[model samples]
Target: MTVRRPAAALASLAVTALALTACGTDQQAAPGEDKIKVVASTSVWASVVQAVGGDGVEVEPIIKDPSADPHSYESSPQDAAKVTDADLVVLNGGGYDEFMTQILGSSGQGKPTVEAVEDEHEGEPAAHEEHGEPAGHDHAVNEHVWYDLPVVQQVADQVATELGELRPAEAAQFNQSADRFEQEVSGLQGRVGEIAAANQGKQVIVTEPVAHYLVEAAKLQDITPPSFVNAIEAETDPSAAAVAEVQNVVNARQIVAVIYNPQTESPVTRNVRAAAEQNRIPVVEMTETLPTDKTYVQWMDAQITALQSALSQNR
Candidate 1:
């Protein structure tokens, strides 16, 4: 279930952020807090920042809940205050966390802001209004860049670059950390590619597009109906016709597995999962945010392993 925060709450947060910005700007770094302060929009991005920043930076993520939908997140006063005082703000800025952007803008802080989506996928295909699907979905641009391993590497590089520019004294350390992170991410890509090669052209259905990039990275075919995906993403019940179409695909066992998100729950999505199970199709759960116990790389590795196991059963 998704909770909708009141507009007044957000307005209050904006006000708090602005006030904090004014107070924080003129003050010197505190005695024990000399490290560079970095704020991220989500835990997934925060983990990357911690990896690249190592001991030289303090990273804070505003949206830390595993179950909250990042797309519809509301900022709290504490989140506003964090962004206001940050030296650098990192966000998945393909229209994903506009609340973060709004807070940063309203704070009037001159901190450096790095947007992962725009920075990582330079010269890539232009995003459709909702880029991650079978076809036309009138939602915002897809901002789930963290699922794409290649893009994650680029975002890490961008983070290192921005941090180096912010504190050039620690430039070498940042670059070194980034190199180590890149190697780990590359390993993940290799594993995913291997799975993709083994399951070439395999068809799958998703409750939503949370893992669309990952599915595509594995070179699997997404046979989900666009209407079904769009409806789930828009937080509405899929129309009767749209629901039936997806049920037909699953009932026929035309796909190898069904990918569902345990974090973002909806009645419609639950129904889809039940149908997939009834048809004896495997169900793989993917998360949009990092789990509290797992690091970014570990989270991706587990999901990839689960997907590989599911696809392997099709043989």
Candidate 2:
């Protein structure tokens, strides 16, 4: 795997032997004074954890930088320390946050972990009925479960369940918060369903699979060439033939919009965006991580609203 993405490279922290008196006691909370310590791999998961934990838990997300690519996240000693102090850990899993695994292992903390991808609910209907294959399903599985609204809802429940295990006393509060979040997010999901219903069978081009879940949720057809998107997701350069295939799709003007990932940039993504512009197709940029300025629901609502606006123009 020679995949590479832009990252703030971090220096590996070396552990040195210290005198027994020099090392103070671990900072982890003693068996329940109330606040549960949580360590999340990314901001998206962190936001969900925070929503569920409410005032009962303190969440520390390792990759909170909005400008950073979660795929390219680099771990540091500070992140490991956070994990060491956590009562529970939440990660995207499915190979998306492999760095978190390394950090946890180094920390030697056997904290209970919750993996969102592993618990993803299945058998979702394809947004675009015209496309024979199920929406969000392909030869290559997209590990971006956060973009899948239903999956996010399911993961919210999972988080509450895991967090509740750590603090049985506040379990009811955690469940209540998750239920509220689900209800609120359902309103957003309803909006997406309505938009998809209005523009059924519409097609789109994506630079990567970051927004595939949302694209499917909106019931839009993704016409992006698999070779091109697969290469981008793999962080490898697509062959000239693969790039040309994407160019042909853009030239054909068959797609209504281009879903671009501004966080992960490459020559291929840039070329696709350039081609979309030349062909007069609207390009909407989406991110994998939650924005620093907005909550998860707000971030998702904004993206769907932008897509609706852009797609409406094409119609």
Candidate RMSDs in Å, in order, are 7.9, 9.9
TM per candidate:
0.84, 0.82
**Model 1 lDDT per residue over 187-242, tens place:** 99999889888998999988888887788779898878788887787788888998
List where candidate 1 sits over 4 angstroms from the true fold.
1-33, 119-141
Query: Model 2 — TM-score against the truth?
Result: 0.82
C-alpha lDDT of residue 131 in model 2: 33
RMSD of 1: 7.9
On lDDT, the candidate that comes out on top is 1
Q: Residues 1-315, candidate 2: write the lDDT tens digits.
A: 010011211121111111111111233233357588888899998898888988888888899888888777788888888888877788886568888868866773445566665322332212222333434345334677788787788778767766655566566788999999999799889999988888887988788888877788787888766777777877899789978878898899988999999887898789889989998899998998888888888888898899889988976
Best by TM-score: 1
Give the TM-score comparing model 1 with the true structure, all chains together. 0.84
